[model samples]
Target: MSEQTGKQMSKEEKDARFEAELLPVLDPLYNFAYRLTLDEDDANDLVQETYLKAYRFFDYFEQGTNAKAWLFRILKNSFINEFRKKSKQPAKVDYSEVEGYYNTEDVEGESGVATTTDMRTESVQDLIGDEVASALNALPVDFRTVIILCDLEGFTYEEMAKILDIPIGTVRSRLHRARNSLKEKLEKYAKSMGYNGE
Candidate 1:
């Protein structure tokens, strides 16, 4: 049914449908938001904003469709909008935090390294996981998003195209380049860790 027809749904029915279809994907939505924002508060705000928009325009959603993809599209758009809005503003700094850090005895010379316990060799799996995450996060937003959507989320190219609002061919090319960029990053780390692909 079209949105106009769907709008005729009773409020209770609408609420029930939303609860069943959308609420189940909350964890995945939050994961995506966290990856994009890399900040818990921002991710929570993004998810909240996405849900608000989705509920407000729930009429536009077609039942018996991929609700996850619909929600993801809304979230991706919200993130992009928020990013653009923030980009236009001057950056904010917390002088108190900087001052407190500098006042601490742990402060070393010009190098910003802290004298914390070494975590590099604590756990092999955790180190690898952290390296992978760092490599993924280092990618540009467009590249990082394609990797998250296709590789991490397991969305088909068609679904990713729809979620990203790009042509299918563009999705393919972007995914290719993103993977290559990620590979290069991981390879550098691997070499540093003495794994020369031998």
Candidate 2:
């Protein structure tokens, strides 16, 4: 839009560009949000808030940059702000989870559907994926986040550093410790599946 930039985009052009560049990252962004909050509703809210803030401050976003990283940074900040606010209040339980537990009858009952474990012989990958997800989720938020950003999302150390607003060294340290923690968590599952520590 600036004359000096040699490219002038109208409002419609900007909107189109924004959608073209940013929309594709929505799912990954939502995945990151879910991993952070561990709640579908919270993740949706976080993603919505991220888009709103990104759109509001679109002018500050430098074009041709890593839009995903930018959106992640915004989402991380929002999650932190929300976390702080929630921490101040008394903890609230999700009654629906309790109610569902009580109401459900033999969750794996008469329905002939096979669960991840049940189909392990046919798809070891699916079972391992579930184990990995469970192990990953067991990690503290900071550790889980580093693993998600680095290993899962495939962000480089530098990009993760920027997204997390930490030094590259800290990112590396955190990721290293996070991986060790995850490995420890998954070791039992791995051994059970015939993967000895050797």
Candidate 3:
């Protein structure tokens, strides 16, 4: 039913529908949020914001449809909006950088390359997790979102297109490039970590 044409739901009805439909997707929502934010507090805030918007616009939501996908779309949009706003703010200096600089100056000469023991002998699998995550995180937002939606969230290409509001062909091409880029990144680490493509 079209949102404006349907008989308006009562507050209790809306609450019941939300609980029955949207609440069950909470974990998936948080996982998506956490992957995007990489911070527990920020993920929580993103999920909360998504739910608030979902609830506020629940009437427009079609019942018996893919609720999880619906919630994901909301969360994805919210994340993008939050990210844009955060990007507009002045950048902050992380304390970790300051500490690292001091430690580097004390241990190694200020001008020369800092020499350290090489762990290149480590197995690719041991190092690939962090490497893969970094590569995934390094992706552009549009590419990253498609990867997350398709590979991570197990959405079909059609579903990903819908969630991303892009054409299906666009989704196909973006995912292809994203995977190729991620593979190149992982292969670089694999070679460094002593993997010989076996």
Off by over 4 Å in 3: 1-6, 92-127
- Per-residue lDDT over 1-198 for candidate 3, one digit per residue giving the tens place of the 0 to 100 score: 435436988778889999999999999899888777766887898999999999998988999999999999888888777755764545633333453454345433432222122235655455556656766766666766788888878999999888878899999999999889777656655554445689
lDDT of 1 by residue, 104-133 (tens): 532234222221123454666776788688
Residue-pair clashes per candidate: 0, 0, 0
Candidate 1: segments with Cα more than 4 A from true spot: 1-7, 86-121
lDDT score of model 2? 0.80
The model with the greatest TM-score is 1
lDDT of each: 0.80, 0.80, 0.75
Tens digit of per-residue lDDT, candidate 2, span 6-56: 465667877998899889999999999998887798889889999989987
RMSD of each: 6.8, 6.7, 6.6
Flag clash pairs in model 2: none
* TM-score of model number 1: 0.80
Angstrom error of the Cα, residue 20, model 2: value is 1.0
Score every model by TM-score.
0.80, 0.78, 0.75
TM-score of 2: 0.78
